[model samples]
Target: MTLRILILLGALSAFGPLAIDLYLPAFPALAQAFGTDIEHVQLTLAAYFVGLAIGQLIYGPLIDRFGRRGPLLIGVVLFSLSSLACALVPDLDWMVAARFIQALGGCVGMVAARTVVRDLCDPTTTAKVFSQLVLVMGVAPILAPVLGGVLLAAFGWPSMFIVLALFGSVCGLAVWRWLPETYPADMPRRPLGGALANYGRLLRDSSFVGNALAGGFAMGGMFAYIAGSPFVYIELYEVSTQHYAWLFGLNAAGFILLAQVNAALMRLRGPQFWLMRWVWVHFASGMALLAVALAQPAALWPLLLPLFCSIASLGCIMPNATACALARHGANAGSASALLGSLQFSIAAVTSAMVGALHDGSSVPLAGVIAVCALLALALTVWTASRD
Candidate 1:
């Protein structure tokens, strides 16, 4: 791949994580800014997941019709504008609303970028490429929060949104200037009914649904950690918000480095082997976490260590699961990619919300949710493998 193309795809992947994570240090501040509770501020994060889920489904068909350029350009522009709106909002409600809009604007890039990768390579290669893709994707989550912490200390929550706005704008311009349109002229623009019908069919396909759920549940478990960790780390463990940023960034660094390892392993084992092995490891992680949660630590450090291991394993899960699901159906890749993304985000929102709702200012709640999700994903993966 051209360095330029890789960068463009990587940036496109980065926008979602950057949009969500960059504002994390601002979470507590936003609660204070609007005279709201921390739980209310958290709902804003959940709202973004809802928007991302809904937007992914819409953009899937739209990209198939319009090709990747127009929809992607539009999404990035809107994402930038929404970031500014979020920065300027006077109340919690307004911030929540703006975040939803920002998520909508950011959704197209993810779907299109994955579709574009699949277009350029076949399923197995798609898996290999995504190992690299995710390392690029990992940069945002790894840095955004640390950057958010710095921005928060220097400029406050409002300024964080401004940084987000600036980030979005820079990405938008880079996309417009540097990225080539990959969808071919010969690609058919399906009618709305045809697109819907295609989605309906894929949803019914047991194998597709199986892989999709295997991936979605795997991500939902991670998203549960994402949604609940700020509370658990900062509130329960009583870590400083800035320190939490550093800690969050550290785990992402683990993910980034491990993704590089997964990429290298793909050369030897292939996507299928690596993914199967990863799922088994995750299943074991779930059991380990369950045991840890039951043990109930007085200090957070021990639990935190293994938790990082599980989260890091997603380095193996996300990219491989995605590439496997997008393997066939090149004719309807946009819709397939879209639905896969939508289900992942949608499942994540629901799972995260459950964790948020159940938050008890203790590690048990977070650990319980994570373990359950991991267990379910493990069951599904095993079932899928046995069927074949």
Candidate 2:
């Protein structure tokens, strides 16, 4: 991929993290504005996740049938319009509805970005490209919260949505001007039934299923950390919100740094080799985290160290797993990308829920959930290796 294409894909892939992180600092203000509690406000986030999962399935076949650019442009329009609605919403229910719409539209970029990469690159290059994309996308988590807080203080929480609207609009423009249709025009279009059949076939492929699920479980562990970290840091560890933001960013930084390193090093060793290496690192770190939680250490560094490692391991895991999974499905790249993305979020939804449900005012729930996800991921990786 050219630098231009890489940048565009990176921007596209960054949508989810940006959307999720940018509004986080405004949660308290949102609760107050809607005359509701934090739990009610959280429904909007849940609604977004639901939309992302379902929307990918909806877009997969559409993009495959009609091609990537048209469906993608429509999705961008939907996202922009819904973001505007979110900014204008008068009630919490309206906000929730709008957020769901936003995610439904925004997730097109996620599906299409991966599809585009598969359309353009061979498997090895695909992994390297994805790693580079991570470097671009990874900036969102580090910057969005601080940026959102600044926007909230200066212009109010609604300003954040307005910014998102602008961001979507710019993305749409970029797609229109520069992004060529990567899906081969001469390729026969699939009917909806055909698309569904493709999904079924994908599931039946042991290598595809194994790599996809392994990636999903690894991603689940990351989301588990994101969900549980606030309480674990602020309440249990007695870290202030200000300090907690820094801590979160530190972990994000680790991820970004390792992703760049992986991009460079994978060329020498291959993505699969490093992928399995990091899988072990991921599982070990999770076990270390569990041990730290169980020990109830007086200092927070022990827990933080393993937690950072667990998150950082994804720097290698995701790109490799994705490259491997979609490698054989270039004919149905859109559908393949959609299923890969949807499965990831599905696993993430489960693991995040586990953290919450298992919460006992300690780090154990968070650590245990991460460990379980790691174990599942490790098993899946082994299964994938055996199948190969």
Candidate 3:
């Protein structure tokens, strides 16, 4: 892919992270605005996760049958409209619903971006391409919260959604004017009824199942961090919202840095090799985080070290796991990418809800959840390696 195409696809893939991170700094403000608790505010994030999980499944078949560009453009339109709705919502319940709708629309970019990579790149190059995409997409996590905090200070929380709406519109225009339909017109289309059977086949493929779940569980841990960090930083550590973004961005920078390293190292190591190695790193970091959280240390640095490591490990883990899973599914790239995304978001939704439900004004819940997820991912990675 050309640099222009790669950047555009990366931006498309970033839609989810941008939406999730941009309003994180406003969680406290949102709770105050709606006369609710942080738990209720967290429901908005969970709702978005749920919408992402369901929408990927729906879009997978549509993209496979119809084509990538059309479904993608339509989804962006829906996302832009839903973002506008989120900006105008009268209450928390309405906000939650709007966020869900926005996810339903925004998730199309994720499914299409991965499928496009599968269409254009071979397995050897897939991991590198994904890492490169991460280099571009990673900018969202690093910048979204900082921008959100600024918007919150200047124009209040609703402006974040307005900005997201405009972003979606720009993405739509980019797709319409520049993105070519990567899905081959000559490739035979599967009957919509067969999507389930296709999914079943993928599930039964041990390599695919193992890698997908390994990656899914790792992603789950990241979502746990995302869902819990605002409370941990702002409330427990007493960091201001603006400063919180810098901390969040620091972790993202680590993630991006490691991803670029993985891409460069790909010439010497296979994706599974890196994936297997990093899951261990992630598990170790997660355990340390849990231990520190259990100790209830007075200082934040003790917790931050392991937290950053665990989050950063995913930089190597995700692209490798995804490339490995999709390597053999070229003909069914759309469906495969969809199922992979769906499973990841489903686990993310669960982890997000878990963090909210288990909130007790402490860091242990988040730390514990990340630890468990890392353990599960480790097990799945081992299983995937055994299959190889």
Candidate 4:
């Protein structure tokens, strides 16, 4: 049963990254296709993030009110249709809009999967399962770009969208055919009023906000990497896009491996202890990386080493921080999971956009954003821990 849930959760979580990364190699092709600049091509990514952030919030309430199956099935249907539209679009504006809708649809799988996990398990189990899910997510970004490059090379930018559409359809069918409704009958049934009340209570709890923010900043630190990596690797080091895919995959593997370590630790110590330690790990890794980046003589080795350490930091923080947040509202899993997931992506999108806006195509901007985010996250984690 845990394996079944893990597979479904992984597939659902992978949707967001797969949707973005699978088409990344086509950035130049897309810019050319629409007669736009590179910056405009990046807007497509930002728009998708915005849609994902908003969609998770909406899906949470609907799932709680109507049950997971209905809202989830509807989301996959919309996701598939929007993906088809993305493939067929004639211009960049059309592509961006379609991508937004696709993200909106795709986020349902993620929100539902998290809510479902909370419904079925206790906090310890939630952290462990979420660790396994991250392993699967780590795979998508690793392989998607390679696959995207091949698709773009053989056919065109649109072909990648076709592949993604097919992926969504397969996932949708799996959910409809096999996934069970996990909401228990005895669990407190909540409508909008009840959901609002729960949210109010969670908002008043500092530990919930603090832990969620720790994870949120970890995400923001990651965005600094995402916004800057292509330039740092491809432009500065002159690595080929195909090679960059492999490089990117290696970093993701680091995330996967470390998350498993967190899962193993959870079997003994509390999630809070692991989360507090990881927050410091994240802060130290970021500062070390930033120091090396700023002291650079423009060597590739200096960049990759610290960057991997910085990414590995998340492997420790993400699952534990999330476990703490969702642990607070076990009774209202769907709504709580929704707000938690929504806040994560919303902060991520905003931070990623900030990195984009402050971009000068240099390593400093990326490292600076990471340091600030990590430091703030560490402080909040400490504060959250002491009170708890």
Name the 10 consecutive residues with the lowest summed lDDT in model 3.
183-192
Residue lDDT tens for model 3, 122-160:
886999999999999999999999999999999999999
Of 3 and 4, which scores higher on TM-score? 3
Residue 107's lDDT within candidate 4 is 94
Candidate 2: list runs displaced more than 4 Å.
Answer: 32-40, 297-299
Q: List the pairs of residues colliding in candidate 1.
A: none
Question: lDDT value for candidate 2?
Answer: 0.86
**What lDDT tens digits, residue by residue, belong to model 2 across residues 125-180?**
89988999999889988888778878878999999899999999999999999999
Query: How would you order the candidates by lDDT, starting with the best?
Result: 3, 2, 1, 4
Better of 1 and 3 by lDDT: 3
- Judged by TM-score, which candidate is best? 3
Q: Which 10 consecutive residues of model 1 have the lowest summed lDDT? A: 184-193
Residue pairs in clash, model 4: none
CA RMSD, predictions in order:
1.4, 1.9, 0.8, 1.6
RMSD of 2: 1.9
Cα shift from native, residue 197, model 1 (Å) = 0.4
Model 1 C-alpha lDDT per residue in residues 1-388, reported as the tens digit of each score: 6877887888888877888888887777887878986777888888888999999999998888888888899999999899899988888888889989999998888898898997788877787788788787888898889888888888887888788788778888888898877886677786666778889988887667777888899888888888888877888788897789888988888777777788788778766567788887887886787688778777778777777887888888877778777776788888898999899999888887888788766777778888888888788777766775
